[model samples]
Target: MKIDGSTVLVTGANRGIGRALVSAFLARGARRVHAAARNPAALEPVVAEAPDRVLPLALDLTVPATIDAAAQAASDVTLLVNNAGTHAVGHLLDMDLGAVEDVMRTNCLGTLRVLRAFVPVLERNGGGAVANVISIGAFGGTPSLGGYPASKAALHLMTQAVRADLAPRGIAVHAVFPGPVDTDMLDYVARNEPAFGDFPRAPVAEVAAAVLDGLEAGEEDIFPDAFAAEVGRVWRADPKAVERRLSGIT
Candidate 1:
């Protein structure tokens, strides 16, 4: 549960939230942090920051071989951050079935594959923690980005079930529900769905820092930013209300 002196592995470590997480690991005194991305070459800049502590690993959640290779290479991982995910921007009704499938494959099945490959590594290390970067939209969805939220909704449930299943193994699973993050992706989403433009966007650095804080504190459900925490409170009190609010059905 502790970050200091722990060996960490973060997926999707190329840029945005993932990149910040890599830095957070170093700042929080992780003994080693394997920064894994589809394109390991993109991780070079992050790995260079702390060449001694940061290791670049080639990992594509959707690619089983890459996931297996990363797990084997980062066998010492004490913490796993399932941050790699894909989003399909559109109304659920309008989105292509294939696009939805891709989202599910990447966000849900991909994460499962990585978890399956890495659980043994964690067990071998005696015990460890897993942090899954889900989204607030899991409880509901916006008019746009339907497939993205649907994928996250599945992951949200998976994280919960995994937490219960893994707790007995001395492996803690933390679910992170972040709201809109200030990234290129956010801008793209906004362009696709103007409604999302109204929501506040959290900085990537702050979100990453909050994630580490929650992990170190052993929080089961982490809302890393103000907007997410606010939504989390309501969702905790009345999930249906949050659902209705997002659905514009209230």
Candidate 2:
């Protein structure tokens, strides 16, 4: 999909990869970008830089009302990026059931809701693209991260399902799998657990650039980071070997 002149909507745009995506999209000459975050005020810098091209929108994907409002606010969008995600960092058995539900609600259900709400808008705009920012964890188990991997796994499957469902309507769905990005999400884990500090982390800009490149190339599965691409290859080669590698990553 041609990013230049396309209208794009990026969720969780306040920080991390989402913030990078907003800047990258603008740099690529998007006509307009709807920067949606739980706290809309956090997108001040983004809006300041591209006031005429950026729309700061308040959105909590878990809440249907907020999703509705965000969709209405970004009705002109032709490209959609689902970047918001929740991670429950503990054993599922030991973790609160509510936290697990939150992960599922935000990462999977919320993404689907946004896509459903925007399909018509994308259709109206002449069938653009939808990019789902998934994670390498989706391809293999990361027991230490608790329900995070399971949630991503669901998103992985959902990405394919969405591609199948939206293809007929001219909407293209792309799944992006990034490994250990240098974002606040990784910091959150590192701060709480020292073991997470050792994982390799790539800058957000690099991952965002790869995703945009993948979109331009019409790739169905985008592995923006090298580690993630290797993980995919290993996964296809030997699932057990990939699992061992993930487990070994402190």
Clashes by residue pair, model 1: none
lDDT of 2 at 198: 87
Cα RMSD (Å) per model?
1.5, 1.3
TM-score top scorer: 1
| Global lDDT scores for all candidate models | 0.90, 0.88
Q: Which residue pairs show collisions in model 2?
A: none
Q: Deviation in angstroms for 177 in model 1?
A: 0.4
Write down the TM-score for model 1.
0.97
Q: Per-residue lDDT of 156-211 in model 2, one digit per residue for the tens? A: 99999989999999999999999889987899888876788988898999999999
Ten residues in sequence with the least summed lDDT for candidate 1: 241-250
Clashes of each: 0, 0
